[model samples]
Target: MEKDRRSLILDCAKELFATRGYHSTGISDIIEKAQVARGTFYLYFDSKRAVFDVLLESAFETILSSVKPVIVGPTPDRNNILKQLRINLGRALAPLFADRHLARIVVSQAETLDEVAAARMEAFYAALRHYLEESLQEGQEKHVIRQLNTKIVATAAVGMIKGIVWTHATGSESFDYHEVVEEIVEWAAMGIVTR
Candidate 1:
């Protein structure tokens, strides 16, 4: 019950933030949207920014948990690797597609909140780029990936994903995230994977 209430508050805050922007969202607004007493909200979160921080952390966890180190065996099957990449992309995107409120906050409002929030967003992206760079370096070393600047590739890939998620979250025209995942994998295969 305690956990559920906390999650409820979080869900409501995410929706409010997505619609209102972080700067415009207030503790009262979250309290009202959550349908919880002001004191109850205080028990869970000290302020609106505190709630936003938790929401941001949760988004990071959801996306990062979907990505894993691609294990390349001595004889790695290219097809299997590509399949895994597709799976990872789908996993990372599924929740975002399901919850556009959270996605909008993550892709759009997160950095604009404040300097601390901006730094947190920056660190999150840096961590993602680091992971991607490391994976690409491993693939190159194992001859699964062609020679390229891993840093630039990682940066571009992260930027592309952010853009796609932003579009999917906020665009007026609807599109399938599954197809987007496949498109991302195919694009990567064409550009990064060795034949």
Candidate 2:
């Protein structure tokens, strides 16, 4: 099927990009890894950069889509809010933890591609910051979160998660996702919730 072939090409390209690095990867390498003819590859992607673009977009979609807005009910239980935070984080982290290749590509190789790629990554982070800032503002209005600079807090939170992912992707030792998620939730709860 056409869809299957396209997915095959994408999977192979993701593997190659993560292992070989974007600049080092070429169309020939991707086609060879994909076991597809030159023309077949062209049918799906115009170039290696095109393939990289699709992969990057896919990664962004997965993470951003995972973040469901934390719902504050009338009761507004602290435990419930923390539970929602844990759920959101776990969902967001699941794909990356499951696929080291994807994690490496998104965290390490995304910004290295070119100016366009760097800008795309920046935009992705900006979207994340905006979402966090909005959520923090809502929490403050609901009296669930303390008063603080939402912009700075959002930026710092995004940076912390990025740094954690970068370390996990690039480090030799593997981490347990559940533990990481719990630690992050605890740290966030301590910093975010009103006493």
Candidate 3:
């Protein structure tokens, strides 16, 4: 019963945050939407910021779980590496596609909302960059990719994906996730420098 009520509050808060934007949405709004009393909300979460932080953390965990399988393994041959890259990109975007409103909130609204939010976003990006860097290093060691600066490549790859995903999420028109993943994988696999 207590768990259910807490979850109810979280779900209501997610909906409100997604629809109303964080700054505009009030604690009373979440309380009313959750059908819980003011005291009940406080019992579960001290403030709106607290709840939003939990939501952001939850989203980060979901993304990591989805992408872990593709990135954590022995480096494969060139063909298999490309295949795994496509899968990795696809899984990374799956959660965003599943809850686009949350994606919009995180991508467009979180950074400027508050210091806590901004910090959380920075931590999230750092984790992603670390993962990508490790994967790229493994690829380099196995001769799966050319010798290059793994740190720069990982940062650039993550930035490119973030830019495209943010645009696709916040855009007016829907995008094909599979096609986008294919294009991203292709670009990552094949360098622009003509050999």
Worst 10-residue lDDT window for candidate 2 reads: 166-175
In Å, residue 113's CA in model 3 sits off its true spot by 1.7
- What is each predicted model's overall lDDT from 0 to 1? 0.89, 0.90, 0.80
Between candidates 2 and 3, which one is better according to lDDT?
2
Ranking by TM-score: 1, 2, 3
lDDT tens readout by residue for model 1, 95-187: 888888888998889877778888999999999999999999999999999999999999999999888888878866576878898899999
The C-alpha TM-scores of every prediction are: 0.96, 0.96, 0.86
The window of 10 residues in a row where model 1 has the poorest summed lDDT is 168-177
Clashing pairs in 1: none
lDDT of 2 at 117: 86
Candidate 2 lDDT over residue span 116-146, tens digit each: 8889999999999999999999999999999
What is the C-alpha local distance difference test score of candidate 1? 0.89
Residue 22 CA displacement from its true place in model 3, Å: 1.1
Q: Which candidate comes out best when scored by lDDT? A: 2
Candidate 1 TM-score versus the reference: 0.96
Off by over 4 Å in 3: 69-75, 192-195
